[model samples]
Target: MHFSLFLGPGVRGPHEDRPAIDLMIEQAVAADAAGFTAVYVGEQHFNNYEPYADGLTMAAFLAGRLPNAYLGTSVVPLVLHHPLFLVERANLLDQLTGGRFILGMSGGRPREGKTWHKHDLTPEQRSRLFDQKLDVMLRAWAHRAGDQPLEFTTDDEYGVMEGRMMPASYRRPHPLFAIGTNTPAKIAEAGRKGQKVHLGPFDPAGAGRIAALYRDSMVEGGHPAELIEDNLRWLIHTKIILVGETDDEAWDVAERLFTGPMVMAPWIRRDPGQDGWSLRKIYRADPGPFAPAMGVPESQGAFLHRTAIVGSPETVAAELAGYRDAGLPHVHARFIFGTLDDPEVFRRSFRLFTDEVMPRLGVETIPGPAGDQVQIF
Candidate 1:
């Protein structure tokens, strides 16, 4: 049951009252102190409105800020960059962090391709590009692994492979690679590559079904049968966690901050012709002329109560048993979502979660305040 500090930062929101760069740095430091296993940030550079234009840059900032805990991207949109460039930068980041880095990549949306890609590729083209780019990046890492600089190109030609990757990645066989996906085929593909994966929070039925799909495919893909379970352990289920001393308190905060405009900020600026328009409308319905609007049903109090764990420490621990039953080995806890503006509040919520919920969930914590024993970064 490894815990992680997950952040999906957007350009708009009340949290943006403070500059995003500063807030993320502060958030990373807090996670390290709280004994979180890792800190993951997103790359949502859909527009000038999106806060994190470059994930590796933020990954570097976090690597510098935290004494412990990993720094990783929610995803690097691989279709947007050359394989060599992405591999070099990521390997360098891993070296700088002393191997405490995780690499995650995604196929960018169509609108993003129109804006940033060298050519206007369709979604299918971008997906192919993602596969090709990632294939080259992995090969580059493998080439760097042996310090090999052989001039001959392989079946999959990566243009201009002149020199070995300097400061070779610290992680053996390269740092952990996680493929982001929402489909069963992609899940199987990630397993075929023996890479990790990221999926959204799902109910027991959904989670169990997905897990079964990945396991069966991994075995069929010639992944070592014995190691299939080990690989599945790398499946990170993302969820928003908001717990306090009491159920009422936790529920109130999650209901208030994690909804409506704050939750919808990331998609508001997207091209209307794309998926963002549907989301904008779905999340836009709650606002009114004289009243504070709530967000889309997904983030609202009732929906979240079922989909996410939002309760007191005791309740959170109990609800998590279902996830454990479904064989989820890890969860990326999003304590810093929506309009959670105050750092103290974030610290308090995380501390309460660590202090109480973690123990019941089989993780042992030394009885004391967060960062009391840990070195300040």
Candidate 2:
């Protein structure tokens, strides 16, 4: 089982004094020192959803510090940028990182906090655009095989290479590419193309449903056996995590630091028109059964239950073992969220996880592809 730390803080409001970038560097360095497999950052913009607006650049910045760990963008919205630019940047990072970059991409959501002139695209249009842009990127990366410079033209997008795409990616064709989405059809398509996937938070049973779909489609699509095996091995699932001496103690810390701020930030700030409801609106209308006691809606508790692994080391390790047993091997854990007033709380939980939970899962330090391990400092 591979564990990746999510380095970006999911902040929702202005916090110029938070020193988020400094803390992020600390987390990356800590993860590398503790032997985490990889570290990832999500691309969120305009709103203070995430401290870093560009995940790829952030990954590049961390690359020098993470000698023992790979770097990845959890989900870079593909529709927002031209394929040529995206591919060039991805290739540069792949070359500089000694082939340790994973480009996880998405079609983007309709309700992005950042406003683009092309915001009016419907879901279908966005899907098609994502597919088209991905094709262009793949072709550009593979153009080295041909003698002629690559030339291509798409709707309102065109590129005529002056010479071969410079600095070929360290990984042939491209660095490891993974699609980020929970939609079954998209997941199946990604599988058919022999690509890995980053799924939303789900239990073993829920994850198995899509996991099976991806595997079956990979086979049904007639991809080679090795590619199928590789795809399955790299399946990623995201989760929120916190560890303490006991479940009750962890829950106390969660309630004190995580729940309320989460409710206010990312959840409440979501577009009210999104699915015709927002968490803030629903909470105002009715705080369900345990809301009064929990100080947030029962819905938020349920969300946490479905998406997080909060407990003592033993309990957390058991749940993760279940995920590995059920074929969800790569866990991308978000250890810090909302406006955390205490960085030590994050450091303590991270220490507990790496020292206790990670050992139970059999995580061991492995050499990077280049066979060099450099300390961050």
Candidate 3:
């Protein structure tokens, strides 16, 4: 199993005297020293949702520290920027990191905290735009000057661009690319393109369907039949984790840290209307069961049960073992929330997980592209 550290404080305000960037760097430094495989940050904007609006810049900052771990953007929203710029920046990051950069892509969510004049795009139009941008980026990275023209025109909203991709990406055809989403069609598309997938934390049954669709399409897209199942390791799953001596003790830590009265920022926040719902609504219509918990203790536990792994080492191993058996390629452990009152809590969580559970599960090092590892096509 591939183990990783996920850091992106969802909330960024008034919690501690230390600056948000400093806190994140501190966490990254600690995780690197402890030997976590990779570190990923999410792209969130405007609202105090995440300290950094640009995930690329944050990853670049971490790359400067140049830990042994790989650096990735949990996802960079492709719709918000021009593809040429996005690809150029991505290529630069790959060069800067010497091929260790993983470009995680996404179409973005509804209810973004920031206001974009292009926010009025219809669902169908947005999908088309995402496709166009992705095509442009891939062409640039693939150096497809013969297959595609260097200059192209896009919608007025994004504008036109022309330029040659001079500095080639460190990795041929660019560094690893992964498209993350829960939608079956998207997963199938990823399989068709031979790319990795940052799959959502769906239930086992839902995940099964995703894996099946992706694999079938992958084979149909010309991948060798023998390589089909072996490539399932790319379904990078996300989970919040905390360890303790026992289940009860673990629950206490979860409740105290996660469901505090002041209500720390959400570990993962996705608003409604971003997926094509009516924009007038303020709160999410599909708040889902967990989103509307209003920061209550019971609700927090329910949320964790829905998406986290919190328990003793033995308990955590039992649940995660089931996940591995179910065909997940990797696990991204989100250790701290925006509201963590102190940094020590996160550091301790990391130490315990690595010390106790990793050995039992036979997780010796960061994930490599072998042994059922999900391939980034």
> Between the candidate structures 1 and 3, which one is better when assessed by lDDT?
3
Cα lDDT of model 2 by residue, 1-377, tens digit:
78888865755456642577788889889998888888888887765555778888888888888887888888898888888888888988887788888898998866671376657887788888888888888888777645687777765388687666766777765778899888888989888878888876775666767788999999988999977876776677888788988977876677666543442323422223334543323423432232221222345434454467878999899989888887777788888865567778888888999999999898843234442322111
Candidate 1 lDDT, 17-85, residue by residue in tens = 356567667767877876777788877654533366677887886777777787777777777776777
Query: Any residue pairs clashing in model 1, and if so which?
Result: 260-294, 260-295
- Please provide, for model 3 over 1-377, each residue's C-alpha lDDT reduced to its tens digit, 9 standing for 90 to 100: 76777775555464542465677787777767666667888887765545677889888888878557778878777777878777878878777776777888877765561366667777676677777878778766765434545655455344434445755666765667788676777778878877778865554445556667887889879987655654565467777778877876766676566543223334544343344432112121333454322232323223434466777889888887877776774677777763556667767777778888887787534433332332143
Candidate order by lDDT, highest to lowest?
2, 3, 1
**Alpha-carbon runs more than 4 Å astray in model 2:** 12-18, 260-298, 364-377
Q: Which ranges of candidate 1 are over 4 A from the true structure?
A: 11-20, 46-50, 117-120, 144-158, 259-307, 340-343, 364-377
| Cα-based lDDT for every prediction | 0.65, 0.74, 0.66
TM-score of 1: 0.77
Number of clashing pairs per prediction, in order: 2, 0, 7
The better-scoring model by TM-score among 1 and 2 is: 2
Of 1 and 3, which scores higher on TM-score?
Answer: 3
Candidate 2 lDDT for residue 38: 82
**Residue 60 lDDT in model 1?**
81
